[model samples]
Target: MGYAQLVIGPAGSGKSTYCSSLYQHCETVGRTIHMVNLDPAAEHFSYPVSTDIRELISLDDVMEELGMGPNGGLIYCMEHLEDNLDDWLDEQLDGYLDDDYLVFDCPGQIELFTHVPVLRNFVEHLKRKNFNVCAVYFLDSQFVSDVTKYISGCMASLSAMIQLELPHINILSKMDLVSNKKDVEEYLNPEAQVLLSQLNRQMAPKFGKLNKSLAELAAHVFQMSMLSLLFPAKSMA
Candidate 1:
């Protein structure tokens, strides 16, 4: 069976950078990994894409011709990709061997992975093609320094899990850039109570009860999702 990694992250979270670095490292080791660009709006790329969604439809063309805003245009482009999966994506997959490893560098739009049907449909198409797919999520390490922002990241990751329900790997990217490594490293072995206490201190007393509930919920979800516990640091497999 074929294997795939859907590289996903917020804008400026280093998805493209990760893909480039991974491709280069693989090349150095004399290993071949196919990189597929799924971001129709992506104007530049660091890795050579084996198959680019832009070739089928581009955000620029959609925006200029349809007079849609950037966000709307991006959504349109992705939906168009979903619509053409059988024809274009299928043909592209046919070019690869059954055991080939593909890394899909996807768009940075959070909505696409959270609530949108586009990526859900896209993953379904891959499964139908006999590929075992795993979502590789990149979360900026800076967010971990602040509890509120860290919780926001968790919520976004949880939303993605709910939407796609794929085997996933959560990565705190750009660790090299984090000036306060200790604060970021703490999450590697997360203590829910400590996190909740920290979160409550950051917010007003009026939200204390609500914060507790959210904490319990986060703990429960993290355990059940098993995403956080599964990997401290991982390479795509």
Candidate 2:
């Protein structure tokens, strides 16, 4: 049973940086962790990849030859990867032993995680291969400072959680760069009562009744017992 982290986030949200830092952290603690570059459009990276998806298909090659834009080309490249999972991905993963720790540095495409079945199918393939995979969803720490943005981030995380049906871990990345950590840290493990108060303050007076309902809903959703809690209910087994 191999352990794997599917590092994912919106573009420029530090998925790659998180992977690099995590890799370094593992090294400092005398642990072995292999990183696989799953971003075909990635031009640079801090960590060396054990296996690269670009070898099978690249956005540059797809775009230059097929005349697709950057986004479309990357989607095409990922779709191509999905098609070759049994062949190319299998060949690359064959070298790693069971119980190996792998970090897949995936593309920063939001659509891939939100609604697309490509990544979902890819994860299913990993499970079939006996990998205990965790989806580490990173959000820029700056975005969570405000109540509205925090809610949006939470919803996005929730969407991914429901879509993939995996053990999800939501990470507020780039914490070191946050100057006003106090404001942001408050939202990390926010209480339902606090969220309700914040929502009431942010909404208009005309929406007082609506805000109350929204607050109750938000509170219910954020409760520890909620089925769709953004935070994973239990430790990964």
Candidate 3:
């Protein structure tokens, strides 16, 4: 009935910017989409928001009222959102038609998507609402320049894929800022052996086995779990 893209990534990975670009693209093509702000800590937006979770709970309010740190406040805000999904979120969904498309701009907290149950529960809620959901994860193009960083990014993406249990897309964001595009392209769809060789050269010989295993796992994750790698520059252009 409905379609949704859960835009998630680490801090500074350009989730909001991606959402704004997507909104503009859809507008240009004469397609309608609702951009929902799921990040309670978010202060500004370049695109119009159809639904906002900050209406229910906000990290700033939580931190000020409960005397909690930023991380703790974010977790608290998300948990509060989970608690009100049946009420607040359901009400928000009721405003849109069954065929409407929505883009949820989520927080940059890595733990929320990886090991936490909050986002999983949110996804389940969307399913119950008869919405087909897909996760669009972003990684900064700059972050994957080295073998180790590439492996780390792959692992994080894989973790979110397993945890979310939805059709997943990995996007390398901020490609416009990558001066040497070839360096970032190699990690986009690299061979497992190539990654292992690079890792072996960078890491100590004692870490050879670990490096090989990591490279293989990264390759497997990309080949199997990830639907595809998207470059923001090309996609938005």
Candidate 4:
């Protein structure tokens, strides 16, 4: 069976960079990992794309032909991908051996991973083709500095975990940019009570109930008992 990492995250969360790093990492370890460019709108790429969806459909072509904006054209491109899965994606993936590992560098669209069924359905296709798939969701480390933002990140990750129904790994990216390492150290395997306290100190007391709920959700999400995985990267210093 094929092993695959479905890399996804919000825009500027380093999804492509992660793929590039992982690719280089695999090369250093003498491992073979192919990258698939799933984003039709992707104009430039850092990693060598082993297979590309643009071979089948392209966002620029869609936008120019349909007069659709970026958002609309991207959605159209994704829907077109879904429709062509049986024919196009299957054909592309079939070229690889069963044991080949593939990293799918998806579009940095949060909604595509959190709520959209397009990717969910795509994963199902991979499973049918005997792929052992894992979803690696990335969030910006800078965005998680504040308590409220951290809680929101947790919820967003939890939503993707439940929605994808695949092995999930959450990564906090851009650790290299965080100057204050102390601020980040406190969040590693953070305690629910401590998180609530931090939020209380950051926001108005009137938001206490909201903070409590968010904290509880984050606790449940981060709890060792949960299947959800958390990965925090240190600055590459």
Candidate 5:
């Protein structure tokens, strides 16, 4: 049996930085954990990679050979990886020891984790390999300062949680960068009533019903799916 954290988030949400920090912290304390790079477009990463999907299929080659744009090429690249799962990903993971902890730094493509079956299939593969997987989603702290953006992040996260259907964690990344920590404090401890009140003030009163449901959705996933998982990082392994 092995344990894994599937680190996922939007583009520029500090997913790689988080993985690098975790790797460095673990090394500093004399702990063993493998970092796997699942992003084919990843050009520069500081952490040592145990398994890399680019070794199998690269996004650049797909773009050039297939005559596809970046977005289409990325989807195609991931689909190629998905198709080779039984042969490629299986072989890569087979070498890891039982009970070894791994953190997979996945691509930022929202479709892969949201509606697409690709990431879901990837997690299924991990489970078949005896991995206890948790989807760790990172939302940029700066993006969620306002009510509308906050709801957007919440909804996106909830969609990913339901799609993945694994243990989920929502992290507000770049908290340290936000000079006024108090500014983004409400989102950290999401309260339905507070969100609703704020939403009512910002959005038109005619859309009150929509705001309420959105707040309820936000509160439900924030509490039931993610809140409990926001413990000290060192304890995850």
Candidate 6:
């Protein structure tokens, strides 16, 4: 069976950079991997793309023709992709061997992963093609610096996990940019009580119940094996 990683995150969260880094790392380790560009709006890529959705549908062409904005055009591009999956995606998959590993650098639209059925259908299509797929979600490491932001990130990740229903891997990207590693580490493997106390301190007493509930949920998500803290410095090494 083939192996695939669905690399997804918000815009500017470093999804493309991570994919490029991963490709370089695999090359150094003498492992072969194919990169697939799923972002219709992607202008350039550091890594060579084995398969590109832009070949089938482009955001620029869609926006210019349909007179849609970036967000709407992106959604339109993805929907168009979904419609042609059987024909276009199947032909692309045929180029690779059954054992080949593919990394799909997806668009950064949060709506696509959270509520849309596009990604879910894409994953199912991969499965039908005998590929084991896992979603690698990236969150900006700076979000961990604040208790409220940390909770928001966790909720977003959790939403994707629930929506995609895949073997999920949450990655906190841009660790190298973080100033205080100690502060970030706490939330990496946080305890329920610790997070609750921190949340309580950050918010007013009026938000006590909301803070406690959020902390517990965040703590549970952090404890899962799927949630991994990737340090880019060591990851590239």
**Top lDDT hit:** 3
Model 3 TM: 0.95
Cα lDDT tens digits, model 2, 3-115, are 88898878878788777777887888889999999999999888879999988999999999999999999889989999999999989888999979999998988889989
Task: Give lDDT per model, in order.
Answer: 0.83, 0.79, 0.90, 0.83, 0.86, 0.89
lDDT of 6 at 157: 89
Question: Cα miss at 235, model 6 (Å)?
Answer: 8.6
Query: Candidate 5 or 6, higher TM-score?
Result: 6
Cα lDDT of model 5 by residue, 55-166, tens digit: 9988999888989998898888888998999999889888989989999999999998999999999999989989999989988887877889989988888889889999
lDDT (C-alpha) at residue 159 in model 5:
86
What would the per-residue lDDT of candidate 4 be over residues 25-76, giving only the tens digit for each residue?
Answer: 8888899889999999898987799999899889999999999998888888
Give the residue spans of candidate 1 off by over 4 A.
220-237
What is candidate 6's lDDT per residue for 90-194, written digit by digit as tens? Answer: 999999998999999999999999999999999999999999999999988877787788888889889999999998888888898889989788787888899
Instruction: Give all TM-scores, in the order shown.
Output: 0.91, 0.86, 0.95, 0.91, 0.92, 0.95
Worst 10 residues of 4 by lDDT: 228-237
Clashes of 3: 0
Q: In candidate 6, which residue pairs get closer than 3 Å at backbone N, Cα or C atoms, i.e. clash?
A: none
True-vs-predicted CA distance for residue 99, candidate 3, Å: 0.5
Worst 10 residues of 1 by lDDT: 228-237
Supply every candidate's count of residue pairs whose N, Cα or C atoms clash at under 3 angstroms.
0, 0, 0, 0, 0, 0
Cα misplacement distance, residue 97 of candidate 5 (Å):
1.0
Displacement of residue 216 (Cα, Å) in model 3 is 1.0
Compose the digit string of candidate 3's lDDT tens values, residues 78-176.
999999999999999999998999999999999999999999999999999999999999999888888889988988998999999998888888788
| lDDT score for residue 122 of model 3 | 99
